[model samples]
Target chain A: MSITAILINAFALVCLIYGFYRDRDKAVKSLKKAAKSLFGILPTILIIIIIIGLMLGFVPPAEISRFVGEQSGILGVLLVGAVGAVLHIPALIAFPLAASMLESGATVMAVAAFITTLTMIGIVTLPMEIKILGKKFALLRNGLSFIIAIIIAILIGVIL
Target chain B: MLLAGMFIVALILVSIYPDRRGAVFNTSMDYLTEMAFILPAVMVLMGLFSVYIPEETVVKHLGKASGSKGFFLAILFGTLPTGPLYVAFPMASTLIKKGARISNIVVFLSAWACIKIPQEMVELQFLGPEFMLARLSLTIIFVGLMGFVIEWMMKRTNGVIDG
Candidate 1:
C-alpha cells in the first residue's frame, strides 16, 4: 500500500478505537453500517475497476498525448477534458502524466483541463453517484463541473 | 445483467486482442488492490460520522442555515486528505440527507476532488508554483460559483428536479 493509503487506514483505525473506548455500542453500530455499505457498493466498485482498467490499458499513449497536445488548441483541450472526465486514474498518478505532457509540448490549457476534469467528473462512477446522491445532483454537479473545468483551463491559459 | 454483459464483452476483447490481456489484467488488479485498501476505511469513516455525529449537528453545521460559514467549512473539510471523488459520494449523500445545503455539499465535493493537500503538493512538484497557484485559485473561485449555480438551478427547477 502507498503511504497515503496506510495513513488513511491508520486514521480510520484510530477513529474506530476512540469511538469504541467512548461507546462500544455505537462503534459497533458504525462497523455494521460500514460493512453494510461496503457490501452494498461492491458491484459498482467492481464495475469501476474494470472500466478504469480498460480505459488506461487500451488507449494508446501516443493517441492520448496527441488528443491533448500543444498543437491541438481549444479542440485539444476539450478532448483532453473529455478523456479526463472518463478516465479514472488517481490524481497521484495523473500529475506525473500531465507534467510529462507539458514537457512534450502539450498546451498549458490542455493539461489544466485534463487534471481538472479528471478530478472533477467521473463517467465511470456516474451510476453509483446517481444511486447514492440522486440523478439531478450527480448530473448537475458533473455537467457543471465539466463546463467549469474547461473555463478554469482557459483562464489558466490566459493568465500563464 | 449489465455486469454480465460487460464481462462477456471484456472476455471477447481479450480473446481478440491477446496481446492486450496483460495490460488489462495488471491495471485491473492494481485498481482492485487500491480500492481494497481504501474503500473499507472510507466506509468506516462515513459510518462513524453517521453514528457519532448527530443528524441535527450535521444539519446545523451544513444545513439550510449553514450560510457562508458552511461554504468555508465545506472547503475546509473537502481539502482534508480524504480519498478520491467516488468515496465522497456516499458522504455527500449522508450530508444531504442530514439537510446539508446542496451548494455547500457541492463545494465540499469539488474541493475534495481537486484541492486535496497531497494532490496540490504533487502539482507543485511537477507543474511549478505558478501553474499550481493559478489553477488552485481559479479552481476555488470557479468551483464555488459552480456550486452556487447548480444549487440555484436545482431550487429554481423545484420539484421538477429530483435533486
Candidate 2:
C-alpha cells in the first residue's frame, strides 16, 4: 500500500470512530451508499480499460512514429492531437510507447499531443461520462479538452 | 461497426442477467471492493470539509478568475491528492449533496486529474524539463478555463446538482 492508502485508512478509521460514536445509523448508511456507488461503476471502467489496453497492444509503433515524424507542422500537430483524443493509454503505458517512438524519430509535437490528450481528453469514456453527467456537459467538457490538448501540443512544440 | 454492435449486445446482456455471467459477476465484485474501500473515506472527507476547510478558503482559492496563481495552486493540491477518480466523483457528488457549488467540485476534479505536480515531476524525469514545464503551463490554463465554462453552463442549464 502507498502512503496515500495508509493515510486514507487512518483517516477513515478516525471517521468511523467519530461517526459510530456520534450517529451510528448515519455513518453506516453513508458507507453503504459509497460502497454501492463504487461497485456499480468499477466493473464497467475495468472492462473498458482492459479492452483499451488490449487494443493498444496491437498497434505497430513504426506506423505511429512515422506519422508523428512527418514535417507537416500544424497538420501533424492536429493529427497527433486527434489521435490522442481517441486513445486513453495510461501514463505508465504511454511513457514507454513514447520513448520508443522518440527513439524512432517521432517529433516532440506528436508526443506532447499524445500525452496531453491521453490525460485530458477521453473519447473512450465519453459514453460512460455522458450517462453519468448528461450529454451536454460531457460533450462540452471533452470538446474543450480536445481543442485545448491541441493548443497545448503546439505550445509545447514552439516553446520546447 | 461490428465492435459497436457487439458492445451494445454485451451491454444489453449485462443489464438483463448481470449476475448470471461469470465475467460480469467478477467485475461487479471488483467494483464492490473498490467502493467499499473508498466511499467511507470520501464521506468522511466531506464531513471534514464541512468541519474544517472554510467556505471562504475554497471560494478565494477556487474562484473563476483567480488566474495562473490559483491554477498553479490547484495543480499543486491536485497532485498531492491520491484516490481513484471515483473518490473525487463521489466527493463531488456528496459536496453537491451538501450544497457545495458546482464550480467548486468541477474545478476540483478538473485540477485533480490534470495538474498532479508530483506525478508531473516523475513524468518530467522521462519527458524532459522543457516538455514538463510546457505541459504544466498549458494544463493550468486549460483547467482554469474549464472551471469558468462549467460555471457558465451550469447557470445556463440551471440544472446543477447543487441546491
Candidate 3:
C-alpha cells in the first residue's frame, strides 16, 4: 500500500480502538454504519472504476489534451466546470477520476475546475436544497459556487 | 441501474476492442486497488463521525456562534467527514431557523460540500500534496469570500427567500 493508504488505515484503526475504549456500544455502532455505507457506495464505486477504465482505454491522450489539456484554454475549463456542476458523482470517487484525467493529458486548470464544481455545486440536488433551505439560498449558493469554482480553478492554474 | 448498464457497456466495449482490453483492465485494477486500500478506512471514519457528532450538536454550537467565531465554527463544523451536502441541507435550514447568520450558513454549506477531511485525504493521495494544498488553500479563501457575497445578495434582496 502507498503511504497515503497506510496512514489513512492507521488513523482509522487508531480511532476505532479509541472509540471502543471510550464506548463499546458506539464503536460497534460505528462499525455497523461503516459496513452499511461501504456497501451503499459500492455500486457507485464500481461504476466509476469502469468509466475510468473505458475512458483511459478508448480515449487517446491527444484527444483528451485537445479538449481539456493546457492548450484547451479557458473554454475547456468552463466546459468541465459546467459538467461538474451537473454530474452527481461522490466527491471521493471524483479525485481518482480527476487524477486519471490529469494523467491522460487534462490540464491542472481543467481538473481543478472539474473537482471544485463537482463537489461544490449540485444541480441534480437543487430541488431538494430549495425545498429544505429556501429557494433564494439554494440558488444563490449554487450560482455563486459555480463562479467561485471557476475562480479557484483559474487561481490554481496560475499558482500551480 | 447505472452500475449494471456500465458493466454491460464495459464488457461489450472490451470484447469488441480486444486490443484495448489490456489497457482497460490494467487501469481499472489500479483504481480498484487504490480504492480498496482506502475506502473502508474512509468509511469507518465517516461512520464514527456520523454517530459521535450528531446534527443536534452542530446546530447547538453553530446557532450560538456569531461574527468571526461563527465563521470559524461554520468552517470547522463543515469540514467534519459525515455525509454528502444534501445531508447538510436540513441542518443548515435548522441553523437558519435558529437565526444563524446567512454568511455562516453559506460558508457552512460550501465547506460541507467540498472541504471535507476524508475528501482532502483522497485528493492528497491522488493529486499529491502540492496540488491538494494549493487547491485547498485557494478554496478556503474563495469560499470564505463567497459566504459574504451571497449573504450580501440575500440581504439586498430580502423577503425573496421563502421559508
Between candidates 1 and 3, the lDDT winner? 3
Give candidate 2's TM-score. Answer: 0.55
Q: Which pairs of residues collide in model 3?
A: none
List the candidates' TM-scores in order. Answer: 0.63, 0.55, 0.96
lDDT of 1 by residue, B1-163 (tens): 6667777888888889899899879877866776676667767876786687653453456555478788888886777634678887877877877677888889989998998764665566557789999999999899889988988988887723343
How many residue pairs of model 1 clash at the backbone? 0
Candidate models: Cα lDDT each? 0.79, 0.57, 0.90
What docking grade does candidate 2 earn? Answer: incorrect
Two-chain DockQ for each candidate model: 0.44, 0.15, 0.81
Tens-digit lDDT track for model 3 on B37-119?
Answer: 99999999888888888899999999989999999899889998478889999888889888898889888988888888888
Winner by lDDT between candidate 3 and candidate 2: 3
Clashing pairs in 1: none
Ranking by TM-score: 3, 1, 2
Each prediction's total of clashing residue pairs, residues at least 3 apart in sequence or on different chains, is: 0, 2, 0
Question: lDDT of candidate 2 vs native?
Answer: 0.57
Q: Candidate 2's error at A103, in angstroms?
A: 2.6
